[model samples]
Target: MKIFTPIIINGLAVKNRTVMAPMCMYSAQEDGFVSQFHRVHYPTRAYGGIGLIIQEATAIEPRGRITDHDLGIWSDEHGLGLKELVSMVHMAGGKMAIQLAHAGRKSRNTFEPIVSSCNQRFNDKYDIPKQLSISEIKDIVAAFKQGAKRAKEAGYDGIEIHGAHGYLINQFLSPFTNKRDDEYGGSLEKRTRFLLEILTAVREVWRGPLWVRLSADEYIEQGHRLEDTLKVIDLIKHLIDAVNVSSGGISPSVPKVFPGYQLAFSAAIREKGLLTFGGGLINSIEEAEQALAKEKADLIYFGRPLLLRPFIVLEAAKTYAPELVIPQYERG
Candidate 1:
């Protein structure tokens, strides 16, 4: 029942060990502005007593957006709605973090999905992404810093760099997707350079806690290996506060699923002596407890599960995981 206890991630003390994982609801306007749907949707979870809420995958630039409706922080104007949203979450007593991301070759929302580096055929029909020039890559890094600044200006508690799920950052991190021969590609050090640059750049603008979310593995052919990801982790160890571990997108296909399916990867990283969080297909109080008890993950990130059961944190504490909850919350 360790899941019910409060824990500090990146120097911020969350009320519980549960984090509302970033899930793309795609409820934004074309200009990357957050809409009423976002305001009503996000703060409600805070009221449900969720510990930490990681905002959905937000684009750092226009083309970096995954879908046309994806939220963006590429400009100062995008801060308007986000400011109000943060205010509401604060008033509700929940901590929030923004996930800054870029879709890379996966830009555009048509039936076809464009992938980075290769002119490979997509699972869907869409335009082939134009390979990024060196200058363009620099611009993307700048965009992430700008987004972090906006998040701070908007009153967010912290920011999380999205470096997973085959996004632009993850694409650059993996040799399978990043085929560029410039300094941005080639060796593991080169592939890892982009994420380090982003974390460093955002640190200048964002004074609050910072975290990096990474795909623990990509289920693709010639995809990134656990050792390679660990290398990336080692390189950026000093730049950020903690690593949020998830998997798949390094490869095209994911393996079969079960309860606590990805805790092992998080455990592996955590054993490296780094603070880490586990994500992907984890549900149930027992499973959550197992994650923390076995040191599989320092924290548990709930995506689809929280959507179905918003008050699961309290439920886990009061019902099944009493050992982890406070006596006050457990009393009648």
Candidate 2:
């Protein structure tokens, strides 16, 4: 089926349309280094025949971590473990990418003052983050550049800028969170400036496939809508390879989600001439095939299912597209 077809993005060829979405494992050490768990967890999925494995939300700095245990690429020392992880994934016959992220106001594990576009708390339970100064913003941008450099040095196939899920980048993009009167706020173009600058910096050092994951719809009354994200994509589409479309993390209100709920957002972004990876609650090969066949998204990202069954892609291939199954696993 079309789900098993090979596709190319920014010169990087993936074996199939099945992608492993970046899911925070919260399994790293306090120093943000990869532990034994990650060493085994990622390669297992790679061996399972996933086309691309986007590693979890790795912090660009200590303060950016979502939890004390989130994986990181903030320093050179962190590269050693990640480099080894990348090698294992490559050996397992899968392409790998890493998501560079900062938790912003949502940062919960650090004692250092959390900084965001504006001084707002994600919720009553979370601490109010300090507003970032212009110079500090520049520093964060440089940090992202360094993160990209580390990813390249670690042999990552690609890098994904985590602009989604109410992180630092998403905070800037959403009006509800970004209440600044400065250049990084107000207009849509202004709100997207942080991400654009990050992409610009990352592109300078990393000449590989780059993806941006965006909270396409904030799922709130005054949050960023599909049209707003289209404008953001239009502004920076030329710099990145593709977009991983996901939604609703800017607020506490949970979106009414179902199978293929985010596909429409992906389709909308795809219509704007941007390649997109999208899927939510997608569990069956038929669902994946239907999404790809309908031209909703260029790739399908399996999250929870992959976590529960590491070899899900292999199982699907064995049942529906036997020719795509790995030869060694054929006997099974």
Candidate 3:
């Protein structure tokens, strides 16, 4: 099936179209060092036959962590453990990418002050974040660049900038959150300036395949929709190799979701002639194959299912396309 077909992007080749989406494991030391859990968790999926595995949201600064235990690349000291994890995933024959992220107002790390594009609080559950100054914004961009460098040093095959899920980048992109009248706010172009600058900065240090995860729709009034996100994509498409499209998380509003609910957004992005990774609530091989056959997305990302059953892709191949099974597991 087309789902199992090999595809290459920006010189990085994967054995198949199955991508393991980044999911925060919240498993790390207080200082954000990789724990033994991460060392074992990621490679397990690689052994189970995932083509590309994007490691969870890794903080670029102490205040950028979603939780205190989230993985971090904020320091050169953090590289060794991540390098070991990458080596393990590569040894298992899986191409891996690291998602460089900053949580902004959504940060739950109480040790440092949270910052965002504006002073808005995500909800009553969190504190109002300090509005980032122009210089501070530049510093954040530099942090992202340094993170990209560390990602390369850690032997990652690619890098994904976390601009989605109401994180720091999303905070700037969403009108509901960013109420600043400064150069980084107001018009859509202005709102996208932060992410554009980030992409440019990261590109300076990491020449590997670059991906951007975007919240394609904010699911609220005065929030970014697919069109808004498309405009952002248009502005930076030249700097990225693929777009991972997922929706909501710009606020507390829950989206009406069903299987493949976000595929339409991916299809729209793909229609604009950009590669996209799309999947939400997708589980079955038939669903994955149908999405590919219908040209809904360039790649399928399996999240919770892969977390629950690491060998799900292997099982799918064994069921419908046994020829695609990894030879190591063919004995079964």
118-220 in candidate 3: lDDT tens per residue? Answer: 9989999998899999999999999999999999999999999999999999999999998989999999999999999999999999888998999999999
**Count of clashing residue pairs in every prediction:** 12, 0, 0
> Candidate 1, residues 135-192: lDDT per residue as tens digits?
7677878888888888988888878898988877887888787777888789989988
What is the TM-score (0 to 1) of candidate 2? 0.98
lDDT of 2 by residue, 6-99 (tens): 9998899999999999999999987999999998999999989899999999999999999899998888999999999999999999999999
Candidate 1's TM-score = 0.91
Can you tell me which runs of candidate 2 are displaced by over 4 Å?
A: none
Candidate-wise lDDT, in order: 0.79, 0.93, 0.93
* Model 1 worst lDDT window (10 residues): 113-122
